[model samples]
Target: MSVSTPMLVTFVVYILGMVLIGFIAWRSTKSFDDYILGGRSLGSVVTALSAGASDMSGWLLMGLPGAIFLSGISESWIAIGLIIGAWLNWRIVAGRLRVQTEHHDNALTLPDFFSSRFEDNSKLLRVISAVVILIFFTIYCASGVVAGARLFESTFGMDYQTALWAGAAATILYTLVGGFLAVSWTDTVQASLMIFALILTPIIVIVAVGGLDDSLAVIRAKSLENLDMLKGLNFVAVISLLGWGLGYFGQPHILARFMAADSHHTIRSARRIGMIWMILCLGGAVAVGFFGIAYFENHPDQAAGVSQNGERIFIELARILFNPWIAGILLSAILAAVMSTLSCQLLVCSSALTEDLYKGFLRKNASQKELVWVGRLMVLVIALIAIALAANPENRVLGLVSYAWAGFGAAFGPVVLFGVCWKRMTRNGALAGMVIGALTVLLWKDYGYAELYEIIPGFAFASIAIVVFSLLGRGPSEAAQQRFAAAEAQYQSK
Candidate 1:
């Protein structure tokens, strides 16, 4: 397919707009704190949308729709699981984490929060948690890079290698320049673009397919099994799909939003806004894939790209069904999804390196100016590594995302949950849970045992380890307990 001139113009304009936002944010970033956490000043709307956009990533538009297109309604279980998980996260973790991180010395990053929460004078918790974040988030960032490369390759008729760097350049530049503020501000815009594209595209697809009944009839004609939610799925398989929800607790990028909110009082509103946005976007994504079966079935000639890669369903639908200009804007949502998540993941990795490892270990007295520059440099380093990891054109976005998601969910989920809710959780117990949880995921995924999602066992094992270790060890320090009580009081009041 030749490159459409309208699309080229739209893409160029969109990229320039994001870069402009980065420069605007750069002026507002006066210190390392401002650079990393936007000075902890996000309101309900920005916090809500930024978190949603960062959480969804390109997987929502590309990977998820692709899964539904290939596997049918059974795949929607993942979305259902995610909704449940996200809602629970907003209700249970958001406000508490916001207040807890502040009470525990105003920690800016997850590792910082863990180290401070446990009063780990040795900094072992800081070091280990930072390592865990870097390891898993590198893989997570690579998934974003892969998703971006796919969009560029398909949309612009570019080859995979050239498309890879071209796709990542804008996101890297903005993140490097403006840091967290840039990422969060752009996320708000990107979230709006994403929701619009998602909602509108599916409506058009449904209409083009001649209605819901007709779409279902066409899908049934293609494969009656595709209509069954439990078609070829065993009980374990269904559970595995739903287990995706468990990942929210430990996602560094999404959790960062909660920690950045202006106050705990805003979280309730943010939660409501975020959940509504998430549900609508997810519903639209699922609809595109399900109805796409009918659309492509009725028009096989236009489906060569989708046949080659079901992940292209959303992209192909946008291009074929809308005017070139509108399709370009719609397709930009894919880029939006890719950039929103990638930028934040890059920033999180940067924070782990700059705050947790560099400043925590090497330069405890590093100046704000120096630290901000170091953080920017780390973003460049991680982005290059992720791009290299994403060099393979054959990598599936969903496959890569799931592996990394499970890693974080298993490793940090139980620890974070226990840390905020259980003041009795000792540093040793936290360490034990973190290490055992991470190791469980790595081993479980490697062995491919039980045909179950690795997170299920990893989360369970981690939770049990935390309890046993905490019970066996001495309790938290007096300071730690006092801090927990203070944060809990604030959370309750809110």
Candidate 2:
């Protein structure tokens, strides 16, 4: 559908509005706390919405919807796995981390948390964490870039390379100015926009399909198992996809919110808000995708002629169900999801370089000003590298993202979980966790079940490394043990 001038104006307005909110976030940021974690005082709303937004983003808008559109009901299992995983992640990780990170040497980065928690010397854990963050995040960030490219290609008819650059630019600009505070606050707003668009799209699509009965009939007629949540997909794929939640335990960008939180106690409220937002937004994205399949099945002529590309379901629904203004808003919501995640990943990457490597190793006495500049410069470098790598015609976004997610899960997930809960977590165990976990996933090579039993193998090895290595080896020195005791969760101020 060639949109008229009015629709074009609507699109421009939404873009301007998003840029405006990003600027607002940048102006308010001051300290590294603000830059990194929104001052650890993010209210319940911002905390919940921002976390949900950062987590969902392109995955929901493009990935989840595409899954449903292509596979039918089988795709819903991914959602079920995600919902259970996310709820557990927040319930289990958020509160403890909020208290534990601060108690353990004021960790602002994941590397900081790991090194301080395990009482490791020579900054091995820091080095490991930084490498993982840089490597996997580059791939994860590319996924967002791909989504941006999708938007430009579908709606504005831009060339793929131009679209990729545009996506990177939008994310870089916002993150460069506001940092994490800007990313989180703007995430709150973007999350709201995403939720709204998700709601509007499915509702309109269902209506256009003559309501639920008709929509269901259309889906049923096609015999697409992609719509049913509990059917069609194999057990391993379901486990592999849902296992993404395991990565949350180790994700610095997600956990940074916990550290920046004012109090661990506050997370109880954050949990309630974050879970509800995730479920509703995710549910709607699924519906939009499934409903689009039904709508398009009945009117194939109206489609944008890219059925295999399930990601287009939402955008095509917008052009079909709504006028230009509403379509613009919905499109912006998708961009918001993409940009929110890209900004967070870029910021976290910068922090790993600035805190974990630069100041930790080279410039222990560096001023906050110098540290911040280093961070900003690293962001540019990282973005440029990701852009160059992602621009290659063959770079696979969703697959690469899963490996990064799996790397974090297998590499750090078990270590972080055990490090927090178990007092005797030894340095050898921490090293083992980092090494075994990362290598298992890398070696598994993402081939299939034989490749580490499809995600479980890597996670299992990671868990084993900590337990077996710590138990079998001698414990740390008296000084190191005392350090761990001092930083244990009990040491945090109430």
- Per TM-score, the best of the predicted structures is 1
Clashes of 2: 10
Residue ranges of candidate 1 with Cα displaced over 4 Å: 1-3, 394-401, 446-448
Error of 1 at 223 (Å): 3.1
Worst 10 residues of 1 by lDDT: 393-402
lDDT of each: 0.92, 0.78
Error of 2 at 107 (Å): 0.8
RMSD of 1: 1.8
Across 350-444, the per-residue lDDT of candidate 2 in tens digits comes to 99988889988999988876776687788888888878777864766546666777778788788878877777778889888888888888778
lDDT of 1 by residue, 180-289 (tens): 99999999999999999999998899899999889889999999888899988899999998998999999999999999999999999999999999999999999999
- Clash number by candidate, in order: 0, 10
* Best lDDT among the predictions, by candidate number: 1
Alpha-carbon RMSD, each predicted model: 1.8, 2.6
